[model samples]
Target: MTTTTAFTIAADGSYAARLAGEGDALYAERWTLAGPEAYAVPLPLAQPEEADSEVLPLADGRVLIHRRVAERHAFALLYPTGAETGPSTGELQLGGVEVREGVRVRLLPPCPAGTGAFALAAEDTVTTVWQVTGDPSGPRPVARIPGRCSGGVWLDRAGRLLALDRELEGITKAVAVDLASAGVSPLLQITEDSDDRLLLADPDSGLLLIRSDAPGTARLGWGVLGSSLPVRFPECLARTGEARPFAVQPGQSLMPETCGVALRLPEGDIGLWRPADRQVFRLAAPTGWLGGSGLWSAQGRLHLPYATPEVSCGMVGLDLPVSPPPPVVLESPTPTAPRPVPLQQAPLAGR
Candidate 1:
């Protein structure tokens, strides 16, 4: 039985997969179409802090890892330790800094340029957007959008910002803010009274995906720009009456080329669906206790970390083939022999 824990793919199509034994440390290995081989490289992140680390691939071909440094609730961004031996040590910067006591820092996704921008949900119930420019040592506030912001997405291409504002009356509305003029407008109003839910806006496709509770199950609903009602994707609905969607891939929009739904199942299996064909394929599964999973690179490969059945703990790399071949079998060879030679020779000798 083979088990894979974590996986990442380089630009050149080579893959790095990590596996762990029953012990404390994690084992990382590299592989290619040639063959699978193990490398004596340091694990991406260290021991106890491994559970909280998040890995994101940058536009510059480098990987950004966000690790929690200490119990004081501080995070440090570092490059992978075994990344091609280019840089010995990566620069560490503090994120979600405590501006005031008891203020928790929930770091949002950075922009595409890796400019170190994040959202801060303050203890006073105010949400502000902060930008860190130049060096990692200097971080400054760029702009602040008013109205208790819970979740937001940067519309870089459209030059707009979509944020969710939670009202005091327990109503949430999707607002669109113009970055240039700093004006805010209500785009969609969610009257479901679900403050714990999240709203996502895909800038590329200009679509919104909402997580809300349905009649008998928790489900995800998709909405286009001009549509009054959302078209629900039944596959994303939960089966056990649980309203939690485990793993959800952000809606990716490559103009004129839209891919379908990609999410993880409750059983720890990753699946990708193409809406046009209504097809679904399994990407990976948990061989042990999977810590976390996400897309490793922009090329559409997934990275997952879990306790390996063979080793202590490890990671697995899962890549969906461009076009997987159908199952086939190879025929075996048949033996040939000189049949009646012995019988003919005995008859001649007797004659």
Candidate 2:
């Protein structure tokens, strides 16, 4: 039985994933708004004998399909007319991106709160970031940064700032890239002995999720950027498994939480972290499904994709209550540790 992993859930609550069944097929599943189940249907795509491809979902429900063709990457925008059926390939448009043959070119997630534009990260010697607005046929390269871009996550809600973990100067550090000014700055300086990766950050609240290995064990920590104090996971919450930052839910205050996770199980150990309480909530794996794809929804409802023992994959919905950070500091603070200094606000679109 082939296993499937949850990739990314779109801004419009649509779930896009790849099912590695007999062949690699992308599944387009419809997630009900704050409901308890998902209606998933496989997207029919022509499989090349032995090639690589990706599915990028647009905010308007159209998906851009990128596949390597004739030593070059080919792209087409797929607009599915229904959730259960696959889109017709009648209007498939080839890409206009001219790149060296066999060079790795990948698609980044779409900005849920931004102007609905997504990014294309190409890695040669250095990483080149390209922005694709409404045109998949004409994706223009935007910023170029030194070191290899591992991947980037939005630092703010507007997608103005992106934090990318790159191997620069022999150390992995989180570098912040401002989309407006094309400005790149070092946000987190990971040490030689300890490694850190930026998961997600909320500039408006200065709340950030960074995977840190300083404690001799890989753990998830929530930190307020620029604050003199340290980002701490409650001592009560033992870090056995692993967790990464998912998406930031929309909200004005903390209680529910602005951010979430897609899937956080490393060894069947599932853990949840709350910024308001600064504690990690541990949950046991559910029967029939060992793990979930990832998590997100505007309403604190978690849309999770899971694989059964039958080698089949499906989506499940969970209504989770939000947790607030602890009212009083329980864990010791790291006042002298290097803290994240906030970046300048990026200008709004058309400003």
Candidate 3:
């Protein structure tokens, strides 16, 4: 069966996802949401194995695709040609960092404000962070944190702050890294025993979705950023299908209560998550199709991609309502909120 892999959507609503193509070769397909259409990008010529390659959509409707040669990672910018042949090559740039055998390298997404600033991480013993500013040069090395590093999600659109989970002294802790100062600070908490696993956070929304063991279960946890008082996502999280969040819409980023995640249901449906009210909206898909997370457009439309049992796939453009429809009028089951999880009591005096 043709399985879907990692997917990413551009700011301009272009969608890209990896999937099985002609024969046994894996290829990345680009989608133009307007037509709800999909097509495969050109496969690499030099190293057709597609080793360590990735396709990331750019703001200008093109794609920055990685093509590896001799274990070195290189990139090519592809321009859409709207034909079944393939995307035409536009520009090429070699990655600055060398590929270490076991070390993992990642190209972080740019800030959501379309700031053209992003980060590249080279992970080994110590985490080396590089700030890429679209300069003619390349990614400029910035912070190097000790121990292991992960969960590298941007916290601010300014590219001034980032949130990552790390092990410092053998204890796992989630902390924020200041892009400007390279200083790391531990995120505060609502209780003493709270072990926060920072998932994805939005500074503008002041809303952070995390995983914690507070309620004796490692379920979704959420709270305002600086408030530091994260609460368990209410025992009645009222969700399934393991949704992946999409980009926040413009002008609505600062709204603390709003957010969205594209979920894949077991019965082959696209589930939309607005956790503020524990809402899940399921949109049915064609039979035998599986869908992935999507991108939120400025026009309040969601562009999602789906994979079929065959090599080809499809895209869907979902229009979000400007105003909430009365719950009683809707067909989707209403999400119910249970009583909030009880907070842990403070430690008495001292041990």
Query: What lDDT tens digits, residue by residue, belong to model 2 across residues 241-260?
Result: 45554555444233223444
Per-residue alpha-carbon lDDT of model 1 for 1-351, expressed as tens digits? Answer: 443344433222233233433344433332332135323233334443353344433333334444444433344444444448552435465553446565444445545334344444544455555543334654445445555666655444322343544444455555555544556665543334433233444444444455553322235544443333333444523341233222223334432123334456655666654323233565556666343443333445555445443744344566644534332222211122101010000011221
TM-score of each: 0.56, 0.73, 0.71
Clashes of each: 19, 12, 0
How far does residue 12 in candidate 2 sit from its true spot (Å)? 4.6
By TM-score, the better pick of 1 and 2 is: 2
Would you give me the overall lDDT of model 3?
A: 0.54
lDDT of 3 by residue, 1-351 (tens): 454456766544544534335555655555555443566554333233353566666656555665545555555555545446754434455345666776666666545545353445545457767654465676566788876777676666566677777755655556777767888776634345556566666454555666665555455555655442335464324355344444444434444455554445556666655545445667875444433456666555666566665635565578654326332211111122111122233222322
Candidate 2 lDDT score at position 249: 46
- Order of candidate numbers by TM-score, starting with the best: 2, 3, 1
**Model 1 lowest lDDT segment of ten:** 338-347
Q: Which regions in candidate 3 have their CA more than 4 angstroms from the true location? A: 1-3, 12-20, 34-51, 67-71, 80-87, 113-125, 188-194, 238-250, 264-271, 278-291, 298-301, 307-313, 317-351
The TM-score between candidate 1 and the true structure equals 0.56
User: On a 0 to 1 TM-score scale, where does candidate 2 land against the true structure?
Assistant: 0.73
